[model samples]
Target: MGAIESAAQAAAWLLAALTRELGLFAAIGLAVGGLDDLAVDGLWIGRSLWRRATVYRRHARMTMATLPPPEEPGAIAIFIGAWSESAVIGAMLRAALAGIRHGDYRIYVGTYPNDPETERAVLGVGDARIRRVGGVLPGPTTKAECLNRIWQSMLADERASGRRFKAIVLHDAEDVIHPHELDLYDRMIERFDLVQIPVLPLLANESRWAWTISATYADEFAESHQKSLVLREAVGAAVPSAGVGCAIQRAMMARIAEQGGGLPFSADSLTEDYELGLRVRAMGGRSAFIAMPVAPGKGLVAVRAHFPETIEAAVRQKTRWIIGIALAGWDRLRWDGGVTERWMRLRDRRAPIAALVLAVAYGALLLSIVCRIAGIRPDWPDALEPILTLTGALLVWRLAMRALFVTKAYGWREGLCAIPRVFIANIIEIAAAWRAVLHYVPGTTPIWDKTRHRFPERVGE
Candidate 1:
């Protein structure tokens, strides 16, 4: 009986210590991260409203002038690197062949020699516009390396045909290309060296859990593509490439290749596309993030693809992103830009800290429940109350903005679902952050962490 009492007392003391320490840590993290998020929210809202009132109102012609389909659109070279993507490559190529309205473009699909299944699928597409570029290396090389081989293939083709590609577009094997995507790229690429269109994840109607997990991506991307990237570009910040639905000037690609020692994409980096856009901006190349409708009644010319619908897959995908942007990216890309650009970089690298805060916050919540069941109430500290309240308010504002943007992109039902989906997103992010730390800290070889993809039956509809 005495040992049982002693054990219970020790557990209570341990719980109290964990609760206090975690609360203090969480408070500091929340104060910093919350304020940063609040600043971005203010900037997005204030800048958007100001532009609508002044710049947009001053030039009615700006809103009125619509770009017509180009009669002589320049030839575009599309690069798609595939390893074990046999499942969706054929469907994606077929959709792109049928859907794209532009006449002057060729797709260079890079395939590994060992990945015969994927190679066979690309060959099975049997379109003249699709050129299958055999990989020099075996299967499972980095995505950047694969893309570089495709670039080499394009260069060889240019040499053989005596035709120069006007622009180079990058895409994954699972993407559902928009019909007017090339048109938008053709019109915009003439002005901006890099043109990035919005990317929206297609929501899968599977099991309830699957639907919720997939909706988390929809909520995040809807808010991010509509609000975050728009604001980043509006504030004169360099827009990072989404690696899909983006076009870069062929000249700029050549310059980038020359600077990077004959490779336009970095073979050593995981997020080569993200770095490519920043590098272009650093080299005085103009970049733009466009979210405009192709026609009055038609939807915006955005790339649509299915994101990971399972927690494990989502974690694996996000783990690569966290490592590339937050960990490895910091070492590769310098923080050398304007105030807004630096701020955006900080936001990009805040994933680990955000994950830590989230874990501590959840831990505190669980401990509080344990204390309550044990009839142990924590001593309320008055000093931390204001900070906690402010952070709580900021969190509410963040969620409200997420819902607003999601509702604008999706419907009100998804907007409401976005509220609870925050928790789901947080869980996946925390897991990814942990995995990224483990994977990156040990200095393991970074390979292409490819996620399995699915193509919707009604693609390009």
Candidate 2:
């Protein structure tokens, strides 16, 4: 009887301690979330108001003028790094070659010697503009390393052809290139050192209504590329590269190489793209993320690609990003910049803490349901009331912004569906953040956690 009583008391104590911890985590996590949401919301409103007050009249004039692209297109080279991208490389190259509106351009694909399938795929494209550069490193090296080899090839190509590429473009095998993509890059790189057009992740062949692994990507990216990056560009904050649909001016890269004493891209980092953008800003180079329509008619010129569609695939892909950008980034790219920079950095690095908060929140939720079933009452914290109120409003605003952006990128159907996709995104964040911690703690070797790519077979297909 004493043992039974002791067991009951211990169990009660355990529950009480867990409940207390949950409260603390909730308080801290919600505070972070609230700040992030507020920043995003503030940026959104500020940008809108600014555009209305000033840029609207200029935009009207630009639209009325119908600006023509440069008569003599600048020499630009597109580089795609393929590790095991045999399935989509050929189709991507073909689609890109067909879609390019510019004349003076070249495409260089970095392939591993062991990756004969991808090499053959590139060769099969049969276009003189496309050159395959096999690297000394074996298959599955970091994307940055592969890109370095491609850079060397680009240098050799420029020397041979006697035409210096004004800009170097980066892309992935799965990307659906816009016809006006290089045109914009050519035009923008003439002014800004780095140019990033919007990246719109295409919906995988999934149910339009079903909340899938890929929809989370679509929802998050829609909000990010449309608003967050736009705001970052506006506020003079460092704009991290989205890996694809981005270009860097050759001159800027040359200056960057001179500064770094070798290559501009970090060969050791998993997210070299993100690091490049930040490093460029740190060195006082000009960069821009263009979201406005540059394509003909009302179409917003953007890069389209399908993200990971399965839960396992999405988790793996996101794990790499979380590890690279937040976990590894924290240690390698020690904090810099002023107030806004610090704030943005905090938002970028908050994923691990957010993950803990999410786990505790879910656990607390389950505990509440169990307590109800068992006829027990939870001792709720009184201090949480106001915080909860503020966080709740932030969450509503966030959801509205997400839905609006998703609608703008996809359509009304997706925008409405993005409301529920929020929960799925949270799940992905939790799983990926924990995985990132695990990978970072052990100092795991970084390699290409390549996503299986699917190319759109036809235009708008």
Candidate 3:
């Protein structure tokens, strides 16, 4: 056939794929995804309005008070699992040691035998407060396994020092510890078994058009920590740890350890921090997620770090998250919780499916564009009118919610930028989700896909 005729044939195939796939399956997927997001939106909005009407109004909007440090602060163990983190570990340790206000704390850096560079970096810190623990396995093992070894090191140190840690804090090698976070954890762990502080992503120094990955992290964490997590705790759903800025009370860890065959952190899971919180809740432990301002000048008490700046790095990091939380978590945790818990779990598990929907939706758009460019109009069925309209409306609502949350975290600039970055975020997430779903087999173990990170120049003291 001639070139023009071949082009027409391809266009025809594209339209057929769009009509058959999108009309039959993607439409329903879109609607279901909309409803799932709507549920969270409803909870977030309702909780916000209620708190504004009651708690904030009653307290006169003065949450940042001159809080006292623990009179007798208990020892705290800080665990950081390092894999290929030689580039950032030393700087992170120095910043953390310098910034932390609490004196009764020890930092343990877990390093694999194969990763000598990271071990050397950790050793170079040479601070009496920092201890480097060799990993049980070689490099690039699952983070959960490394954390388990870190916990063991914490226990050994506890035995040697004759001082028990009141609580154990979790952190990453790239984290810039906030000055007030340890103090906050010190104060809060007294009341709750598990305490989680907000995690903020630091934007890169370079000005570039291709850095939407950083913005995606900023937007997601801002909304999640500010709204979703708070709402989840209010509704009695389990609070998943951000893997940084999280602390579990010593006694709570002991209890979870007792339950998990002497290992509080599961070696089988990719998202151990997430599972830790949920499993603790399952064992009837109290958890707190506090987002209030820590100091008079500083905003919330949060661990700040720069996320993966490039697309490949971002997708690899997010793929681990999706695999651990959505897929592996579902397989392990199963559906065992109250109404609120079940609802939240459903939202969490919906990620892979929603990602597929995103892929299909974008594919449909591309097909339509190609057809239009080829001067071929698609004769979509009239039955899809309502489905298309509702899906469009839901997409708008989702975007609006995302923008508002991003605005609350960053500023109006980022909020407006989030509108465009939404597409970029979805594309990245779809790629990650595909890998996550495809990587798992019935009895096979998942490989650790670690994301390399960098420390920003400035982290608040």
The most accurate candidate by TM-score is 1
- Tens digits of per-residue lDDT for model 1 on 9-56? 888888887787788778879888989988888988899889889988
Per-residue lDDT tens digits for candidate 2, residues 58-120, read 756232126566554688888889988899999998888888888878888999989899999
Greater-lDDT candidate between 2 and 3: 3
Q: Candidate 2: list runs displaced more than 4 Å.
A: 61-65, 206-211, 294-297, 441-445
Worst 10 residues of 3 by lDDT: 60-69
**Lowest lDDT 10-mer window, candidate 1?**
60-69
TM-score of each: 0.95, 0.94, 0.93
Question: What TM value does model 2 have?
Answer: 0.94
- Where is the poorest 10-residue window by lDDT in model 2? 61-70
Clashing pairs in 3: none
> Of the candidates numbered 1 and 2, which has the greater TM-score value?
1
What is the Cα root-mean-square deviation between model 2 and the actual structure?
2.2
lDDT (10s digit) by residue, model 3, range 1-461 = 69999987986887766655665467778987898779888978888898899997776542336665666689899999899999999999998888888788899888988989999999998889988989657878778788888888888877997888999999999998878788888878888889998898887757564367787888888888888899889999999888899999999898888887888888778889999999879989889898868555557778788888888988888888888888888889999999989999988887898898888877777776776776666666676778888888998998898889888788888888888888888988999999888886644566578877888665552
